[model samples]
Target: MPATATRADRSPRAAEPSPRGGRMGALWRVLEGPRALDVAALLIGVCTAVLTVLGLVMVLSSSSVEAIGSTDGSYGLFRRQAMWAVGGLAALLVLRRLPLRVLKGLAWPAFGLAFLLLSLVAFTSLGHSVGGNTNWLRIGGFTMQPSEAAKLAMALWAAAVLERKGRLIRHVHHALVPVLPFGLVLVVLVLLGRDLGTAIILTGILATILFIAGTNRKVFIAFAALAATVATAMVLLAKNRLVRVQAWLFGCEGLETSGDPCFQPDHGIYALASGGWWGVGLGQSRQKWSYIPEAENDFIFTILGEELGLVGSLAVLAAFLGLAVGMYALAARTTSPFIRLTTWGIMAWLVGQAFVNIAMVTGLLPVIGVPLPFISYGGSALTLALAGVGVVLAFARHEREALRREGAPDAPTPDPSVRPQETR
Candidate 1:
């Protein structure tokens, strides 16, 4: 045997792995391990899990009073919620393992498919309308919300478009010609389904993506103004929407026991008031005794307020804020503009919609009939929103891996000198 080999074999550290080999193993482990974005992704996963589980408990408590008298047993809403949870988890796991580039490749095709579905929802023969909105489709016994799919599809398309256009994206003509037209088509289609809320959410996601992608401020302002105008007009045109406007503007309708305009909102406020600081001691909401309607869906947060108290409501908001912060942190870390833009889009959609929903419940904004993201019930909406988050998480994951491969420090920062250099 070679002298060095023989010496090592007989050395005091004979059983120990070689320092070089150990280092290689350690490097390999770090290389193989999940990225920071993945870690950030996990924080979001935890937030959603906490929200979903709490939502289920709240759903059961809030819905059972109505469920027992219905066709299904007391477990009806609970069972459906449980199934949605399982399905959403499966989607998160499966999509997390998918390559970000693969989603990039499929962006346009996915958008096309989603657009087709959006168009199909208006045919009347294929779509299902409930509560005055034709936003769902009957798939066997289950219904799929096409608008939810539209939100994801629009995000992908916006990312892909920005990636392709790159630096040229700042031009007014360029931003309007294609991007504005595409979103208009989506907005029109969504409105055709009489679902202005989802359309507004989709527009919010797209606008945030564009802003992050470095579009001109003038263009963004103009686009925002246009969207606001259309949304305002749409609200005025719809009957119930006008009711919401009245409630928001004048606070005309107050609480009533039953059969009145402010029935639901009144009950919600009453429930929140009844909860006091702590709550009415969970699972014992008086307003949920058929006093509050749709407690499992739109007004679910009221149940949280009534049962979990202000502290619990604040905690829920904190979890959501943490999710927004984590996503923003991941986006701030990524150098790849596409990943950053995508994260911004997802954050705007999730956080913006959450704000709108919570605002509705607190009477800070009009009742928009928007779900509270992961905290609200409904299968199609929950799973689709989560799956979109999974895709953005993949982008964040790849960016972290890219940084690690560069052998750089964990914390990344902008170089002040680079900006002037780039402008020059």
Candidate 2:
């Protein structure tokens, strides 16, 4: 007591601990534990598993009638889908284990291979046409859609290039040069094969990557407008597409029921309407009995809705929403521009395609021939989609390691401007 203490000095030397601070400390401690997993990574993995399993079930149910009619028996299509599922899961496991550097190294090669495959589809005898879109390649007894592989390849290539550009991406010329030209060529290739749906999805992937890389605002808007114009022109130029658009704009009324322009849309609506709030029950969809074409492919959602009702439909949407949240969270947490852009690009591919498929089935949009990501019956689509997820999972694994090394707090903030210290 060198001097008389004031009233403030006489008060307690330590202030009471804040409840919020205590909770935050507890959370950090939990996250810092040795066995801790990244919440985002877990969420994504779980959702993917759920959707894929559900897809297999729905494929079996929806394809039974078609499979029995077209193939050896009811299980033929389901068996093929199951085999592809096995291959896809294997890919997911292998990809999730690879280092991010290895993925970056593979990007260019993937792009080149995709380009070659697409070229074969567009100009060679190997090209196989289905539903008027010659986007598939046939060899011996096997067939695959090159455009599906291109979707993943383009996303990877764009992310790798744009991330390397760094702050230079702010310049329009630097941002658009090779990326824009290469992307356009890929889209043109797909279009040459008459796959407008795949072209649209590919264009979306490019735009998403560019936006994530922080391209100039004016340039981005201009690019978007140009893309819209091209898409509209392409639609108007195709008689089939134009007819579908007309059906979407004007009701299917006054058209002959036998060869109706809105036959698919009308049947899709009927399937959904037949199922009340609870659905008709699994394996009981009358739509799959040939009322809706492509019951196991493009219009699987309608069959799902018909059998499982609105509840099942909502469940599928929730799974996709979960995927979206998880991917967004991973993208936000990573400091690597490649990881951020790739995550966003894949997100656009899967989630965007899912919504487009659902919209088409619901008649909110014209029939685009896009498959629902995990639930569709195409081997190429399922395999590539899983591979894309695998790449993102690899990024997520890297993020989890980074968090562990840094001993992340309750809310770890990453600076996007700073280059990540650990490239591997």
Candidate 3:
């Protein structure tokens, strides 16, 4: 043997693997088996369930006074939200049981359906306006917001298109051909309805999908700048939107302003400030009793802060972070392009919307009237967000099934005493 080889063999370090290699091997050992997907699914499911249950409680507490004043009793909004929650859960279970191929096949048609519903908002007398956004489709007692459905449809459609293009998706034109048209149409329809919040969300889903599909940075930046310009123009064109932006910038600072736009934002700040480190206790938020508008809908996070305190608010934030991490892990575990894109799109939409809602309530951003995903009290929003989680759960289970077919062994149980290490 050569001198170096003989010296290496004699060295005690030769018997042990390098730390980086050891960690990589251990990770592969853990993930190569079938249990990784199961753990991911459990984490996602638990986080979602906790958020759902917590949301129901918050809705009950925040909407009680309004419910009693508007209707007959305190249970009015709570009952409605409970019904929506039950429906959302059933939809989740049903979607989880369906095959991926079926969902892929339905993607285009679903997008079309979502588009048709959104368009109907302009022409149909059934279109209902609430809090200045004419995005609600109410036919008698049956009411729905098509923009909520549009968000999921947009994600599914983008994923399917990107998967179909495959390796041919090199040029910007190839990437933008169908997605831009579809996304632009949706954005225009939403803007026509004057729902800037949902419009921002739809744009975000498209932007994220395009970036993930390997569009060049120059192209994405150009598109982003164009989007910003258009959004700014829209804001300036509408007097109410301009007022909201102005109010958001100066109203929180106790600046002199004469408008109703600052009303809710100011109360939202008060709610958070009054809560301090520990809240005044659940069901005891004074702001919910007509002080804050949309207490259970858009401004629900304020109640969460006021009733549950800073600790409770942070707990909810942590739960969302956990869900996002778990979803991304599932995306990483998959090889299918469609699965990866779909997972990422849904993750961005839900988490992105949650942050936007929270920021608006906390006075970090202008209020655009988006709900807090699973934690807000909107039937369509809650149902679609849960359905997105179901899609993720299905992907996780699909991965598990794939591992089984590959004859992977059961993963070794992790020891609690072992400190986890990262590979370089």
Candidate 4:
């Protein structure tokens, strides 16, 4: 109420939301206010929900024959997958409201717990080998891959560390020193689990985070090349990995005459090849009838292609690309180095995971049991991914508020008075 202030002198309450805001402005206020991040979440959410439903249908198609013999009902695996989908969505909704700071506080503990689980699985005698990887722990009727949690924990921890020691991030000693122990820990845990795929994904996330934190580019590149070398070596040493790699690179050169260790990839390639342009039909995928292995998990995209065609598969890929683009865009929009780094890291993680999964299915890369996010048929992976999405959404919402508060000029509203000039 300054005396000199008149109605015209006052800033317009511009019908549009405010745009000028900083980090503190993204915090959730005590009073209810407009949510600015809903749009991003909605975009991601709609895609996930669609994929979830699609997953259930495909799981039913892919799992029924095996389930009929393994369980009393034909829908056993599909039923369980559906339940997990429902539960995962609920968990994501709950997480969407929490502020990023709150989650950051829990990051260290989460990382510790994830590491503990990885160790426990090795000793407990409960860890079962699936497709030659001893990474799954079964408790009662429930089973989960601890590595999924490990991935999220690692990302959060990286973000926290980089945020706290940002200035030293440019120095080799301080920057790489901090990440060295963590990298070692992750590598050892994953090596013990024999889950090289998960380890590779973690490496990608770590590298992205480091680069964003201003680590020396040459150092980052050296670390990356080293990781690639180790991964290739591990694959070459293991029969399972070798088979997949051979299948991917050579495409069944003299292998199919005997035992066919790379049979799954061959089948996967067949499935993709069968689907020319459109697809066979919805729920009518011939390859899912016990042809391709892990039809619902590692090779779900192939099934999507087989049933829905190249168009469907490409659509899914395009959506993933769009999501990554949007996430990175959001990160860049914010000035906070932490948000920027974390956002880019997460986006890289998604891209790396997606490419690896799809590549494994299409026989372009060696098979490692990574699932397509949101679309694959696994509860633990899906749930952990949803949580990550929640983090991004909260940041996005805060970002929108920040944009509004910063007094960013609103996009021009439609001119009701002016109709567009139509072509004569």
Specify the highest-lDDT model's number.
2
The local distance difference test score of each candidate is 0.77, 0.85, 0.83, 0.73
Candidate 3 residue pairs in backbone clash: none
TM-score of 4: 0.83
Model 1 C-alpha lDDT per residue in residues 1-424, reported as the tens digit of each score = 2222232233232243334457646643332333435556677777877877887788788888888867788889788888887888788777777787787887889789888988888875778898789988886786788888788788788888888888888888877767778877887888898888888888888888888888889998889899989988998897678776776676655622233557788788888888878998888888887877778888889999988899989989988887886687577656666677777887888889999899888888777788988878788888877787787667766765665555456645445455334553
Superposed model 2: Cα runs more than 4 Å off:
1-37, 253-258, 408-424
| Candidate with better TM-score, 1 vs 4 | 1
Sort all candidates by lDDT, best to worst: 2, 3, 1, 4
For model 3, the stretches where C-alpha displacement exceeds 4 angstroms are 1-34, 252-258, 408-424
TM-score of 1: 0.84
| Local accuracy of candidate 4 as per-residue lDDT tens digits, 80-116 | 7777777777777776677767867877898789878
lDDT of 1 at 107: 80
Please, what are the lDDT tens digits per residue for candidate 2 over residues 1-424?
A: 1443332233231123224447656543433333323766777898999889899999999988877756469988888899999999999999999999999998899899999999999999999999888998999999999899999999999999998899999998998888989888899999998888999999999999998899999878888898889889988898778777877898667643445778778999999999888999999999888888869899999999999999999999999998987787667656688998999999999999999999999988899899999998989899998999999999988866765555546645666566667876
Which has the better lDDT: candidate 2, or candidate 3?
2
